[model samples]
Target: MTLMTFVYLIAGLILLVAGAEVLVRGAAKLAAQFGIPPLIIGLTVVAFGTSAPETAVSVQAALDGKGDLAIGNVVGSNIANVLFILGLTALIAPLIVSRQLIRLDVPIMIGASLLTMGLAWDGSLSKLDGAVLFGGILTYTAFLIVSSRKDKAAAEDDEFTKELGLDETPKPYGWVINAALVLGGLVLLVAGSNFLVEGAVNLARALGLSELVIGLTVVAIGTSLPELATSVMAAIRGERDIAVGNIVGSNIFNLLCVLGLASLVSPLPIQIAANALAFDFPVMIAVAVACLPIFFSGFRINRWEGLLFVVYYVAYTVYLVLFSTGKPVAEVFAAAMLGYVLPLTAVTLVVVAGRAWHKHGFTGDELKR
Candidate 1:
């Protein structure tokens, strides 16, 4: 890679960190001042804000005619969100689950993910597919607003008035500052994505790796930095709701908003790569479904569980790298993943879904928080 590219890549990482910090803090303050419930802010504003990088990058990639990058970025991001971000955060502190997420967010996330997979299964995400995804975002946001209002009414008077000192009320300069932050954040996101994409492409070419491989491995992990920062910060602040919500919500947004919007700009035709279909997409589904055990088992993710997640993620990365480089050892990894891991994951999903139904009786009590 050229020296300039390295500089741009480093600069992009710095900007991504700075932008996410400003955006999160600003959104928190604004939500507090507006009397918006913490749950709503965590679900919508914080979730969408942190996902801005993926959105920008994916759209740019599509426009540049590198549609695989756009698709791979979103798919890879969802995997990273669950395996990497959630895993690391849980290691720091076990996440406490809210009933709201268990009932509403997690299921919705799964549905969206499955929907995306189904849409792309036909070998492309057309403009119509994009519209459907974007429509889901609109519907989900509206539901949150309506639900928050009803929740506000049913909440105990003290509950509504309880101050979360972590979130500051907006100051007179809040709009000005926030607008600047949002704008700056967008700029950095765009720049960082460009540099990262370019550098990644160059490195892949030099190493004789396919773009799809690079997208699934390096690009995916790199763009997931925002989720890592946001979730880790939320965990540090003891904001378990934000920590868990950020990952789940970002995954949803990455699939719907980011890929949805990107596909609208340019249809993403599937390349029929065996790794993507047989391995990567299935892994995405598996990692997403893996959440059920953690979320439903005890409504929390303990430190040991967190370590397990990290290990799974590391193993996943190693397998991908080895497979890409044509290593003989990859056959063992592939066989293990497909022959054992995939079926095990499927069984887990079925069992978890059944338990969720038995516990909640199809009425979704998990949503009652």
Candidate 2:
């Protein structure tokens, strides 16, 4: 890459980090002002804010006719969020899962992942598919709002009121300041995304890499910076729910909101390159499935488990690089996946299911309640 390109890339990253900080702070302030429940704000407004970068990049890529880049970025990012970001955050400290996340958000994330896979099954995501995905987003948002209202009402009851010290009537400034923060944060998000996308595309060309590769690696990671920053901050602050929620919510948004919207703007035709179909997508699914164990077992992800995630992520990246460069890395990855990773994942799932059954019984009726 040219010196100027490197400069832009670095500058873009700085902007992304700064923008995310501003966005999160602004969002939190707004949430507090509006008397929104912490969980609601974290899952919806804050989650969307942190995912703004990914959305912007994907949309821009689609508009620029690099639909694969757009789609790849979102898919790659979801994988990174689960395996890399969450894993690293947990390595720093074990993340505690809120009941809401374990019961609601995690399942939603898995559903979104499966939905994305299904939509792309025909080797393309058309405008119609986008409409379906976007519709789901709207439905999900509506559900959250309704649920938050119920939660808020519940919190206002005698026992909850005493415990949380909630005020029945919020101050007048609540709505106004929240509006300003959301607007300003969105402005910064748009600006930062532009810079990052421009720099990333240029860098890819300089390195003689396909836009798809760039999207899957550099752009993916760059767009995911917001999640990394937010999750790490939440972990450090001991806001375990926020850390875990941010990762899960962002992944869902990446799959549904970002990719879906991009596809609507421009239909993304999947390139069934053997490597992508065989390795990349499966790796993404593997990462998603990997979380089942970490989450279901005590509904917690501890530090050691997090370290294992990071190791796997590093190994994944190395394998990608080698495969892309036409190196003989397939055998290594195949051996690892077949011999160790796949079996371990299967075993973990079985154990988690058995534990859940033992604790909650065979029927899921208790879980529903």
Candidate 3:
């Protein structure tokens, strides 16, 4: 909390946000110019671009031998993506959930989250685990590209088309300009991430906070700012597909690309924190699973649901604070959540999922019959 620490933290945050905006702008523009469809860009370029800040920060943390920070960042960002980012965005506007997301991406997200937790069970992420995770992303990306081309018309109908599409007048920028933008954005990301991580580590030591705590709270929030900005703007603009899809895709990439690559680059296995294993990882997976019922019920997230998400996030953060500080109220909070809140919530989600499944059995034609 020294002046220099605060200065670096704020400056780094500004740079991360600016860098991600530039990177996404250049990459989105270039992708559009290449005739890549909008849905694909939403799922790939925009999502990954927004997540670049997390990638840069986590990878550098791993290289610097701050494995706790690297792992915490990935885990915390995933949690924040669903609970915090999506919740906030949906509060601004109800998000239209794509059928493909419910059918394909949500399952993949859940599976990836579980796999990450499983790999870390031994208290570390090995290079082999990193390879497997990164490989999944490459394969998934290839499949998305091929499918988008085959179904170009459907892809074009996506909400991102209107958002990321070139101007109606279509003034084309040269390849050089696009490349420079991308390069400049990358430079900014690296420098900003360095400052941010350095400041965070220093602040943690000064405050007697563990690296993992700062990583989960401070670093995770800072790195995820780009996602918040992109998603909230998309939601407000009524580009709901990009808003929801951006969160889902960024969560996926944070695990597959950010954590995976970071573990690979690190000299030693990335140690997993005990608290993360006992509670946080399960919560992350549960949050991923929660989307299934919510998205399936109506193919849209309603205002009430958004509010519920926000409340849950706040509760989770409060629990983290209590547990981290070893406050006397920690046990009471944990008991209440485990004994009452979680069970009720689980029952509610199951009921909704069942209703959705039953209703879905009869399409308009079948219902008429």
Clashes of each: 0, 0, 0
Best by lDDT: 3
Evaluated against the true structure, the overall lDDT of model 3 is 0.83
Q: Compared with the true structure, what per-residue lDDT tens digits does model 3 show for residues 1-369?
A: 689999888888888888887887777767777876667777677767888889999998999999888987888888888888898888899888876787778999999999898888999898999998899889888887787667664646455766665443445555567678888898999989899999999888887777887888788888998888888998887788878878888888898888889989989888888888998889899999999888876677877888889889889888877777778998999999989998998889789867876877435222221
Name the runs in model 1 displaced over 4 angstroms: 21-43, 152-178, 267-274, 340-369
Stronger candidate by lDDT (2 vs 3): 3
Model 2 CA deviation exceeding 4 Å by range: 20-43, 152-184, 267-275, 352-369
Model 1 lDDT, residue 45, Cα? 69
Between candidates 1 and 2, the one scoring higher on TM-score is 1
Model 3, residue 197: distance off in Å is 0.6
What are the TM-scores, per candidate, against the unseen true structure? 0.82, 0.81, 0.90
- Scored against the true structure, residue 238 in model 2 reaches a CA lDDT of 81
Show the lowest summed lDDT stretch of 10 residues, model 1.
156-165
Candidate lDDT scores, in order, read 0.74, 0.73, 0.83
- Give the top-scoring candidate (TM-score): 3
lDDT string, candidate 1, 134-189, tens digits: 99888888787677767664442233234223334456877677677667766776
